[model samples]
Target: MRDAHYEWRCKAITPIWTGDAYQKNGRMIPSGLLGSVRWWFEVLVRGMGGPACDPTDPDSRCPDKHGNRCVVCELFGCTGWARRLQFKIVDSNGQPVQAAIVKDQEFVFHFTPLRPILDEEWALLDLTLRLIADYGAIGGRTVFKPSDERRRENMPQHKDYGLIEITSWPDIKVEERQLRSYLKQSHWRNMDHGDYAWASLDNFWCANGKHLARQNKDDSNFNRVLGRDERKTCKICGDIHDPPNKCPKNNRYPHRHSENLINKNRTNQWIAGDKQESKKVFSFRHPQRTFGFVNPEVIDFSEMKKRLRKAWPDLKDDEFHQGSDLLNDLIRSPGGAP
Candidate 1:
């Protein structure tokens, strides 16, 4: 495979990431652009049938360290493999970007290729780009998923869509030219160019559900529910849904005092919020464009309000709640009011 390079310009569609952990210079990007790229690469690999590993599962995310490395790790590099690529990021002014850490801020990145990639790796990298354009950020929050209830109603969840522009040497084959053309009018210049991006490199979007997790049984986000009491049965319906976190009733924060709304009125004995506290392990889901446990404290109060409205479309913008407050509303009341 011959060596070649490509360039990309992007804007943060959502607050890339939030929280003190990601605090830096004046912005936040998703665990650094490379980290986000790695995530997309993994997703592309799995989505293309490269491997069945879950992006959130470390054991599966990376290949066996000793001798068997997965296709993703081989190119993206992991403890088991050396990275097949290298990058150099900069602003439009041609100055290198700095990830100084800023809490709860939106960030973007403008990538100017610094090294030529082997021709074979181009396809995978192209696949990665498709994912970014189609999936936005990979781990904490995703771009194209509709809410469970919304989907059941036959609503197709459209991708929240991120802003991205790519320019490459014509001789080099690139993926999705139409997307790039729409992004920047197929602008091509013989000379080099540059731009700026602000993504919360240290934000928790990388860890919200899977990154924050320590285990996975090797399946979609649907089956990764956390288990606390394997033998416990739902008191209201006397049903046993394998993992205890499957209760549709328990909602929000620290996982304790998380109520089971199912038994709310029927038994007046709703899983005693705190009774199952010590014995319950909470299952976390992939947060769609909406933010969940990705460091809410560091997220801008105003932005939090905005994203909250989307998460709970039933609520008006003026009445949108933030943090756990919004979550509490998600658990329907005994009367069926959201």
Candidate 2:
């Protein structure tokens, strides 16, 4: 069987962290980068109004009652199915990368098809990589929050990780209709209500030239936007304490509204040590950019913009790009525009 293979040369703009199971950084893990690619691919699928199952959730994963899979599952695979693409990272000399942290290095992403890959699938993958190179980030630790621990330390301004430039790519042309038709296939449809949020293009929002501010004494614009824990004070004694826990002086708790972007409910999930997973808003410090999808059920576009502007006064109206608008602008094919 003839296998479809493609390669792209990439340069890491910042440090790339593809850590091991122990969360130790300093080595290249192909699976780590593949996972990030899959994530962005899933986001793109959902943004384009295609079905993509949450692979992490057993109930929402692929191989449904009819043995059908979502568009993402068909290519990336899930339980009971193997991925169609084999991914690898090699240095400029075509040697396997030995470094843990991929910083300022030129590497190549080698993708070999394990099965007969379709043109639409290749187009989708190409689009995803291009998006990451242009406006988004890749790999892990892209959303590093310096305010958490290094706020008081005299450290240099934190640079964004996972930023890469695609220096070269194989010549492959696919029409927009091909992708649309492929997504419309019956086998790629799955109807499952999962807890994981689907990042649709209609709900996506992004901006450049604005980033989280570094720590300035106790003031950090970025931290303020992300939100800080405000301990509730005892109503009687005026002592601070976490909710549901009694204060030193009094048993009664104070009733106050939270001003955090990530509320109490989401903050509690961070106890599992995956703070990035719990956050909805993602920012890059060096590029001065932020991008995230909003749950329209929770907040509308105007309201979300208002809240962000409240924290970032320098942000202008012209700087923001709605997901739908970006799709139309970035995609070249006629049918690519939504």
TM-score of every candidate relative to the true structure = 0.40, 0.80
Q: What tens digits encode model 2's per-residue C-alpha lDDT throughout 202-223?
A: 6778887776553433455554
CA lDDT of every candidate: 0.35, 0.69
Backbone clash pairs for candidate 2 read 26-100, 27-100, 210-288
Candidate 1 lands at a TM-score of 0.40
55-125, model 1: which lDDT tens digit per residue? 35554444544355555555556664466665555555645655532222233343323344444355456
The clash count of every prediction, one per candidate, is 24, 3
Q: What CA root-mean-square deviation does each model show from the true structure? A: 18.4, 6.0
After aligning candidate 1 to the native by TM-score, how far in Å is the CA of 244 from where it should be?
29
Q: Which stretches of candidate 2 lie over 4 Å from their true place?
A: 146-159, 227-277, 333-338
lDDT of 2: 0.69
